[model samples]
Every structure is written in structure tokens, then in C-alpha cells.
Target: MSFAFTSRRLTTLALATAALGLASAAQADNKNLPVASDGTMPSLVVTSTVPGGAFAGHNKRGVALDAEAEFPASRLTAAEQAVFAATFKPKMAPYASAAEALDPESVINSDRRFRVYPQESGYPYRAVGLLTFNQGSGSFSCTAWLISNNTVATAGHCVHSGGSTGVWSTNVVFYPARNGGLSPYGSCTATRLHSVTGWTSSANPEYDYGAARLNCTVGNTTGWLGRAWTTASQVGVPIGIFGYPGDKLSGTQWGGAGAVAVSEARKTRYPIDTAGGQSGAPVVQADGTGPGTCQGDCGIAIHAYAASGGNNSGTRITQAVNNNLQTWINQP
Candidate 1:
């Protein structure tokens, strides 16, 4: 299928803001500029075909997590290793706040995360999984979740290296509710990748969110998470992050919940614990309150970075983001 933004491009932000009454006149005006000029950009969509097949062969059912062996060490090339290292730069500190600080006992050895087992047993959890892909000269992994029958939302960095010199990723695959090597709902490969020019061309964290259109309709069986955006402050709102973390057993889903510590125009920060592989995980409302347009189990941000300054952060789902996601979700 050809990849391109839908008819709703230029006026999407305007209409969304007006309908939701979420942003002020100044905020809406600033968001309407072209992305390279430090404003929102149109979504960039790319299409690719899985060379061999779309379905990953590993569909072992009723497999025990403990019985599976650990994944082998990554065989990244020197150049790829350097690129991976750059992602860890603590350029920004966590959002400073008294509530953002956690008690030592509140976190177990500085990690408050817990594993989610029988991943396919329920909503939200079953929709999230490990996202493994090949970029440059190495293979890497991140987290992703379904938003539509064939669309999986993820971090922009997971799909492209970012910036003027970056390249789009290859051999992308999504393993929904994967427990160790057991793919309860099977696996699917990406046929299309979508992000914004702000991220693909400028590597801006404000736009560091992306989505993939799968070759299979696995989300129908797994169910998908609802998404929402608001101009209202998100501080103190209870939220959760669920995804496959590399710090734990391979393919294991670990998650945690905490109050939103900081809310920026394009970012949201929290005291939640997350590791490298958890990037692109959904940051959803934990209080079961579905704000404007949220159907339930609604995601408000795409978890993207580890604790900087103080709290972990992600790309907040703003008006422009919601517009692009709505378009992507309805793509044929």
C-alpha cells in the first residue's frame, strides 16, 4: 500500500483544538507552524514488504516462561554500538518536584517494576509486546502496542535512527503478549512505518512517537489500547507503563504505575521505573478515567526516555499527535 498522510493535514490541529477546547489561542497558533521551524509537522509514512513472510514462525503455545533460555547477546557492529550509546546521553534532568522523589523502600533496589504474567489473559497487557528490529548493522528491541487491527504504536527512534543522517529500520517485527519465547497471539511484521518530520528530520524528542502497520490483523484477537490527548495538566494523574524490558528475562513484560510528575506542551514525566527496552511503551491512565475521546485504557503518551534530571519521560499525545494517530489508525 502507498503511504501518505490522509486528507486531514493542515487544519487537523485547528479542528482538534476547537472541538476539544483544550488549548489557548497562542498555543494553537504556535502548533500550526511547520515542524522544522519548531512547530508540529505532518506525519511521514513509509511502506515496506516483508521479504520472506509476515508471520514469525515461533508460535509455541502453552510454553513455560521459566523453560525458555535467555536471549543471546546482541551482535552489534562498532558503529551501531556507538549509535546505541548516544541514546543514553542524560541531556536533561528529571522534572524536579517533592512528589517526584520516591522513598527508598518504595522502589526495590531503585527498580519498582513488576512482571506481568499470562500476558494474553486481559486487555491492555495483551495488546503490548516486544518490538525487535534491525537498524544499521545491528539488531535491537523496543516496546509497542496495538492501536488498530493492523497498527502498532511505538517510539520514533525504534523505527528510524532520526536526524539528517539517520535511516529507516528494517526487519521489524511485533510479538504481542510474548512470554519468553511463547507468542500467545503469534507475531507480525511491519508493512509500513509512520512518524513525523519533526522526528525523522530533526530528531526532536517532542515528536518522538511512531506507528507501524502490520501485515496481519492480530490486534482483532489481542484487542487494542485507546488513546487520548488533552491540553489539561497531567500532573498528579495516575499512569502506568507496560512493555518488554531488556533488564529482565527475554520477552518478559514488566510494568509500574506512578503519578505524572511533570506535564510539558509535548512531554510528560513521571516517577515510574522503566529500562531501555521499555521505550515506546504506552503511558496510560491508571485511574480508569477516560478523558476526552478516550474509549478506556487510554494512552496519553508514548514512553520514550529513561529518567533524566529526575523523572522518566515520553512524547505527550497532543492535538497534532492525536490527529496523525487517528489518520494512521484508519489507513487501509
Candidate 2:
């Protein structure tokens, strides 16, 4: 897919100055922790569950990670599609494509997100999926990605109503690489959902992230993405966001890439085009060089909100978030 980027480049002198400023700040704040190792697991709260116990299969041992996208031999048969359609109703309420509270000018004028054809056959792409859950009387949809053999990371709001009076979502299901009525990898029900207290208590956007432990070890087949946390400024880091968008064809995965425009202590902003269902999409390192601070297919943030001032944003991976993810990924 093609991304629209301005031809402007930062000069060597400017780059040097920025680096020096960052170095000084890091030294002053002692923020130079090792990206992959510094995080300590934080306490997590259960936000939802599947009552009769959803666990069944044992996780595959020594499963190898796929370095590249894989294509399926064939699409689902008509009978299979019919069965899935009858059982899994597509009654998802559209997440707001653009946050109404934000300035309209903050949103990108052009929607550059491109559909991922045969998304179910792609590696990292397939790991990203459509998340549908029951929240009150309605079914709502969001995006999520596999971070472990049996767990997926997503926006906290996708799993919980948020705040002290918030209610946990129920009947959460994940359809990896779902394409319209085509569920190439089938789907898995989340047995247990997780979130942090900051969001569960105050609906804080900074803590607007969560995970769901699946009833199956599908990540062993699709392969999960790695995550990293860094104190360094992520501005200009090339990243891609891929997930199902409510505005596009239902259940279709769309994606786009762009450099981080603004990097704050807990959030990163970019101009990559996205819509409502795209929340919880992985903000992955797009250069293929891996994250400078972590190994493998590393993701740096969880895409959470729409354009605020001039760009869309995600909850940046920080030490606490990283630690919690590491712990969740290891949970049986």
C-alpha cells in the first residue's frame, strides 16, 4: 500500500540538536531504561469472562514464529461460511470513526487506509483481528492483535465500559483476519478479559488498553507480534496500523503507514488514516528492522483514539504496560 508523506527532511544539524536535547532529558529524568527488560509486571483486574471455563487445548510447545506472511491454500467452503454466519451474528455497533469531541480540523482530510486483500493469509496481518463483544444491549466491534499463544491486546474500552461505574463486556470473540463474511481462521471466544485499575476506576485514556485470553491457542498458528517500551522520543518512527474499520466493508482489514508526528510520555500521535473499528490495532514498527529496543515483530503502541489536534493517537508502550503484557502473555 502507498503512503502519502511530505518530501521534507530534517537537516543533520537539526537532528543532532534534537538528539542532544533528548539525551539531556533522559539523563535528567533517568528514563534510559532497557526497553525490553525494564518493565515489572503490574497488577491487572479481570474485566470479563466466559462462565463455564473456556480453556481446553494445550498450547503447542516450541511453535516457530512466521517471519513472513503466509497464504492459505483455499478460502472457507460455503457450508463453513453458512455455519459461521448463523452462529456469529454481525450485529456490531460501529465505534465512532472520528472522535466527535476533538476538533474536526485535527482529522486527516484524506482517508489513506487500504484494504488488505486475503488478509487471513498474512502473518502479522492475520494476527490482527476483529473483536466483537456485548456491552450493554449492543454488540460493538474493535480491533485486536495476538501477543501470546492464547491472548490478544486491545483497547480497554473494547472490553470494559470504563470508570468506577463501568461494566465489563461479555461474550467477547476474536476473529483473526476476518474478511467480510470470510473467517479464514475461524474465531475464538475470550475466556477471560483483563484491564488495569487506572482505566477501570477513572476511564483514563492513558491507561486505555487491555487484553483477552482466548479459549484456543490460535497464536501458535498465526504467530504473535512482539511488544516493546522505550523512553526515547518516538517522533518520526515509521509505524503501521492495521485492523478492521467500521467504515469500510464489514470485517475487512485496512492499513496505512506514517511516521509518529508527536510523542508524549504515554502517547504517540500520527496522521495514518484510521476509523472506529481500528481502535486496538497494533501500532507496529514498519521498517522491518525491528524496534531499536526490542526483538522480533515489535509493536510500540496500541492505537486507541482518533485525531486530537492534528493526528490520531495510541497508548504508548511504557514500562508498566510492557510488564503487564509480559505477564498476561505467560498466563495459561
Candidate 3:
């Protein structure tokens, strides 16, 4: 409910500035979508997907979206077209609900989590689910990252979907899979799920992120990533990311070896795809050193990169660190 626009509802909006009805490669200026260069930033007209369908919906449990075809556009501007191409694809991942395919009563680390062997030193995290309304039959899931055996961070939108109707709690769970192969499940009930005054009032995706204080350490597991950087996030940094993609399997590493990008939207183009299930993962960056993360990544540390990126293949604060849901989940 963070957005009025869901996969379920998408109505057309009339254009005011048809100045450039459709920007193309020929219009290099339009391609960049200049940010700080201009005194005023250009507002991007997004071609939103219809709500409640399978356009890009990832699967989890039993809730899934079926395959659907897209119509070619003749009314898109340059940026809209680019976003369309960037997001436009065939069969990314399957969508499902949490209980749908899970082996009920399965052990956490054994069946659920795909443990990640960190080559470098940094934090690891993942998302969880909380049963929702409708007689236990129709439930909504929220995303969270395991900070330790007990804490995590997530989007405020994940918790309170505006007002009493969408806000959810109870029976919360966490899954850590820096890799998509295996996933370790952990239980963490929601002790607190609040957002900034600015975030609640404004459905701003950037400000919509939130954090959760878990009741205990994530099953008392050791080697889980610790927390760092407590607020007012800095830009121009390269960030590592992780998440459980509902479309495909979990434990993703889709970008090529060291194909790094910035933490712009908290999402990047990578092969390790997740539709809706990969919500609430962490986007971390290195503190000391170890293994690294790349594009097509989610939920890792957040940082702007160093130049050249040979020894440090990090991303820029420009492309990668924009519109991110910056929150310190389970950061103690």
C-alpha cells in the first residue's frame, strides 16, 4: 500500500508537456535525465504496470501471477521508453506465496536458507512474512533483513500500508540467502514498525523505508553481519545488496563477476531476478574488506564506490544511490 498504483490499478494520465512526446537516442540530453546539472530536475513519467496482475509480480507461497504479454507503445517519451525497455522482458521469475511451495515444518537453515560464504567482510540480510487478514486465508507478507539473530531493517510501507486496514503484525519470519541456492529461515516477531513523519505523510518510495527491532538474535546464529552507519546516509558510495526473488529461486548473483553498480533505486539489472518475494532484503557495502556485490543485486551495505574499481569495484552515488529506501534494519 506504499503506492496508490499497484499491479492491480493503472489508469492513463493526460500529457501536459508533450514537448518531447518520446525521447530517443538522438536526444542525448533526454537519455541522461539530468539530475543536479539543472536547477530543476526533470520529472519522469512512469509507465506503470496494471495492478493485481503478473506484469512483474514475483511468486511466493501460493500467491502467484500468470504470464502476460505487453502492448507496444506509440505514446512513450524517451525516458519512458527506456524504462520500458529496462523493465520490459519475457518471463523473469515465477510468483508465489510463502506457504504455497514451502515444505511446511522444515528446518530453517536446512531447507529454507541458502547460506552465503562471505568472501569479504560485510553484513548479510533477507526478508520475512507476516500472516495478514481474511480469515488466515488472504494474508500479506512484509520484507525484513536479519541484522543478527534478533534484529533487521525494512520499508515502512512493508509494515503499515496506510491506516489500520493494511497495517500488519504477528507470526513474522526471516530468511537469509545471499546466494539463491539455499535459504536459512529465522523467526523474529515485530516489536516495532514505525516510520518518519515525512515518510508516513508522503508515499515517497525513497523515504518509505523502515527498520524493525527483532525480539532476539536470529536464532542465535553467529557470523551474521553487524550494523554500521546510523543515519543521514552519504552519497557517492558503492553498496552491496541481497534479497529473496519470488520469481526465480533465492540466493541470487545475476550480474557478471564484479559487474558493480550504484544503489540508486535499491534495484538493479541483474539475472538473479525475484518478482515480489524478494522484498525487504539488505543492500550493504564493505566495512573492512572481503567479497563484493554487483548490479542485479539487492539488500546489502550502501556506499559510493572508489574510482577505477579494480581493487575496489564499487558503484557511484550518481546512478546507483538514487531513490533508495535508506533504513538501518536491525542495526544495533
Superposed by TM-score, candidate 2 places the C-alpha of residue 279 at a distance from the truth, in angstroms, of 1.0
Candidate topping TM-score? 2
Better of 2 and 3 by lDDT: 2
Q: What clash pairs does model 1 have? A: 93-308, 93-309, 94-308, 94-309, 94-310, 94-311
What does candidate 1's lDDT look like per residue over 246-282, in tens digits? 6676677888988889899888988888776787899
TM-score for all models, in order of appearance: 0.70, 0.71, 0.39
Error of 1 at 205 (Å): 1.1
| TM-score: model 2 vs. ground truth | 0.71
Candidate 1: regions farther than 4 A off: 1-109, 118-120, 290-295
The root-mean-square deviation over C-alpha atoms between each candidate and the true structure, in angstroms, is 10.6, 12.0, 20.3
lDDT of 2 by residue, 187-292 (tens): 7888777777666766677777888878876766666776656677788888888887766767778888889998888888888888777778899874343334
Off by over 4 Å in 3: 1-137, 163-166, 175-186, 227-238, 250-274, 288-332
Q: Model 3 over residues 1-332: C-alpha lDDT tens digits?
A: 12111111234444432223223311532222221101232333322222222121122455311111011102345565345333412111111113222210111121223333422212233222221111122333333554333445454445444322333333343333233222233233455544432234443333334445555443233223333221222243444444433333322421112233322332222112223433444444344322321212223332111122112211121221221111122122
lDDT for every model? 0.64, 0.64, 0.30
